[model samples]
Target: MRTTVPPQEKLSLNVLPSEVWRWSAASIAQQIRLGSISCVEVLQAFHRRIDVVNPRLNAIVHEDREQSIGAARQLDGLHRQDSHARGILRGVPVTIKLNVDMAGEATTNGVPAYSRRVAPADSAVVTNLRCAEAVINGRTNVPPFSFRWFTEGPLYGRTLNPWSADITSGGSSGGASVSVATGMCAIAHGTDIAGSIRYPAYVNGVVGLRTTSGRIPAYHPTTAQRFYGLQSMSAQGPLARSVEDARLGLLAMLGADTRDSTWVNAILEHEDDAEPVRVALVDEIPNVVVSDEIKKALQQAAASLVEAGYVVERAQPPAIDQCVEIWQSIAMTESRFGMIAAVEETGDASIMRSVHNMAACAPSVDLGGYIKAIALRDELRRKWNEFLRAYPILLMPTSCHMPQPWGADLGTVDEMRELVAIQSPLIAVAALGLPGIHVPTGMSNGLPVGVQLVAESFRELRLLCTASVIEREAEAGSALNYTAS
Candidate 1:
């Protein structure tokens, strides 16, 4: 229920740095509830930050400046009425990905033809954020249909990396990652079907959580049909500067909604007192090529986990290669029917070229082949499940190599295939509908590199707890403070 606002007008306040835009969502909410700072002041700080840095990055494309001010004022009024009333994300500025629905806003998904396709109602995640009193300052950009690993489109233009303009900002949630990394917002809402959230978080040097399927209620009112892999494999999650902030955002987003019956009512954390679980570290993925820097990143993360009291074993997850193939088959088959057709009808040359090349990597499956793939998928999920029962968490590289240069994905079919191979760590977890966390360890060759932590479904708490240990040891802010040349 919406809290009643006080009769008092919006309070006049002065913005303060070091405690304003730089604070995490958890800290912002706590400070606002404690009356240490007015909600208006916090909002103004982010508004000023966005004004200064957004033009250079182009991360946040659609902003309702007046609406945001009004919302912040409303939140301040509510706080005045009941200082005790504090949602987990109260007054925290958040940037929503353009692909998700926000009432009366365009769910463009980077297609110019559908720019007028305004959402009549908020998606489940948006409603949850509003209920948690998050101020929606702006919307982040995405690739056409959010399909590419590089964030650029004909509609909103390309989102440049804060570290290097030559490299990608990482899509389809590239804009979301950049927003958090550059202090555009405390937390950014993003989706991950096949590494969209984690990859961007890796490249952008932030913490991203790819919650298990159904962990967060998600539904786009503008979407016409329900595809096979969309709900089962994809998830709405948060990308933030720190693991604690991401955890808070995930807490705010967890719940069941009638609109998305597929959502599970799972507890965020178990009450049992268990020791830190064993971790499987995979530095060298079989048959996939990776740079020495990537290998060092894996070792660094594993070493941190060991120091934090986790039993770090050097082992690979089962069926890594097969799971990647399953992702290709499922995505390719589903795309042929819906996503591919729509892209062909409305997509620009860049997206069309990337999509076509991706298709070349995986042939369209027939009905029988599709059924077999589903059966194979269940078997693979079973393997991971049983394996996870033994090793509760698996730590691996987010990508085999560093972030690709701009327009790398829009290359020859062979190049796309190589890209897919390097991304097996992300693709495999996606296919099994598991939870993965992308935590940046350090940088290599002037770019960020990180590790992916995977856990069983409904075990996000386990992943976060372990990631926090590594985050603290790694001193997470070095990359965030790096100034691009």
Candidate 2:
């Protein structure tokens, strides 16, 4: 709860505007490098903003003000010496999700019992961020074990949505999105297995990227066990107010890491610059009921893409519902092996209820069924790969509707199933390990709504480019600039 601004030794006496906190990560780093702004000034501005905004939102659960200031001072020293800092994110203020390891901090994952589980070394993502000289401002919150669509834990309490307190902030990356939305940080590290990053960004009126599996290496040294479903579905990404910043973060976090054997060094951009990007606009899906606001947002995004010269067609990807089913089957099936037992031992009442309800929704299968599910998952990935080959980008609703009220998923087992059904677009694409971006369109009835732009693995550059155009349209329509404090 230390909210005091950093000592203003190298800072300007004139009060900076509230909008200073909203500068994109790229712009912040550029100014810092150009000697126009000191890293200390940028970090202090964010810490001041965090004090003003995070108290109400509870988006940042943990902070190390001294550590952040020291890091910024070091970057300033490098600048004084006429030596550049690290990579593209040098001197940029950023937040890390609490589930990941940052040296000397606990990887709490919102569990009270493991509050003492301090990490001895940085996780792969943290290592990458440090290498890029991205100053860590604070650690964001998550649900216990990150096991729900809403972010509230017995240890950390709840992360309120900046837009509406009644609605969900969207877990397990809820705090990350809220932090970005409120300008707590320029970039937020987020990981998504099923809609964790995208859903929160959708509700918070920000941008979040769920990169393809293995695009960003992730490893928690304290909890480093191999989980099949997690290995296949989970991806490390970034949440920001702009898609360009998200793209910058994704690039900085990429490349192979020995810690994660699955990490790939594949080229991230389009192979052929002259190739035309084909976008599939999916406004409706069979058996999915989307709100009119959601439909309008999708149509608006489609029109934006069309204007941007992307060949937009009204079409749906193959087996949308089947992909969701596979996600539930594999994710729940793999969790049963060990995660369920851990939750039973240490989870709070809310998380325990959610785990049970989610378990009830996707019953555990025998070995034969598990094997078939894996094989079926492979088949679905093949089909999606083929489909994506035809349509390089798919523009669809991020969620079937706006974010639900807090604790909606904790209702009856049937209610949990309904919630999952609505999140089919998020879960399905995750099942196939594709990269998806949540691009916010505008507000609806004081709530945020947006569309999802998905691309084949390693085609994140294309998705970001398409989202930039949609972002331009959204900015033109909305009176309140999201980046403005």
Candidate 3:
């Protein structure tokens, strides 16, 4: 299904910090640090925005007005650290994907069954952000079991795209991306096991980062273990409206945590203008039908970057299909062990059964295969590293298809199978554990399009530079089509 984007929202230049929710995270941080706005003021700004837009969009499932306000209230004079005021994100209003934990909040993961079960403490991502003084405005939407590419809860129904209400905001992190896109939060935190971070960013016309695995330490309140494969594929990153916000979000979230053994040595050589980006325009790499609109956008972005003095080549990516299978073996095994256990324990198996049954397709490997998967995963890492020895960046469509409708069919049975196929492009890219950036480039039917930039480990600086160049080109051409309700 296609969607026509409505006109862009009427943003007031007067309130720069609160104007576009996409960059609001960084904007509010600056305001709070400069004392131009108090933490309470910034938090209240976000709260008011939620009240204004969420009912129409349904992007945020649960919100805490009092707690958000209270957090902001404590941010008064945080700039004066000598006076004992504390807040790293002092006054910054942020949203967490419902899949993650926040104290006293339910890690719903978009399921109705767990709505009443509250978390005892924050996830590591949340704790790190809080340590930096960010106020948790609310929990955003997710696909049921946090698996699909569309946000619909048997609990909350649907999360409509803010730019075009009929279309989706993209899933797993759909609600978070939508909330950030439409001024709900400055930035929203999202997880990337597959393409949760990048696809949503593409659909929402924002900046989303999929940091290399082990870069941003991931920890939930409940789990203490992450298997090697899961550790390799499982990484958490940030989604924001702007490149700098993405940079700041990554800086805030990347830290060592006890829960994840893989989270270590984040001493990345951060460089914005990292030489000529050896880029490959991998169009339809795995035979996925690349939409003409997306293809045009990719080609346009590549040409613009080339004109901007970067070396661009239309080459093939590392064996994305093989990488995907390796990733699937690991991901499905972990899913069965974790999600299936939860399903069986509950016995209230509706969506749970569907989730488990789907996971059953790629059951865990034997000890030998497990060892081989690890060996192969490492081989892929080295292969990508070697490829980057030549090319620094890769340009591609974040997804082969455009954004689906709000209540699209990515359900149980056929739905699960379809999503598994549909999500392949993102999963294929993500399986390699590289840093990919989704930069909003153009629009169609009032919705947004993004150019996906894949870079080697620690090449995020180069990716951001490419995005900055693309951003300038896009701005020089046309602004994003932000159709308001």
Evaluate all candidate structures by whole-model CA lDDT and list the values in order.
0.85, 0.83, 0.72
Which stretch of 10 consecutive residues in model 1 shows the poorest summed lDDT?
1-10
In terms of lDDT, model 2 sits at: 0.83
Model 1 residue-pair collision total: 0
Better of 1 and 3 by lDDT: 1
Weakest ten-residue segment in model 3 by summed lDDT = 1-10
- Candidate with more favorable, higher TM-score: 1 or 2: 1
TM-score of 1: 0.94
- The candidate that wins on lDDT is 1
lDDT of 3: 0.72
**Which candidate gets the maximum TM-score versus the true structure?**
1
* lDDT by residue (tens digit), candidate 2, 1-485: 12111111233324334466867787787778767788899999888888887777898999999999999999889889875655778889999999988889999999888899999999999998888889999999999888788999888899998777899999999999889888889899998999899998888888899998988987778877668777888898999878768877886777567888778877765544224488898888756688899999988988887886889998889999888877878888888888888898874778888998988988468888878888998999998899888998899988997789988888899988888888889999899898999998887887878899998888777777777788878942221243225
lDDT minimum window of 10 residues, candidate 2: 1-10
Clashes of each: 0, 0, 11
Q: Output the better candidate (2/3) by TM-score.
A: 2
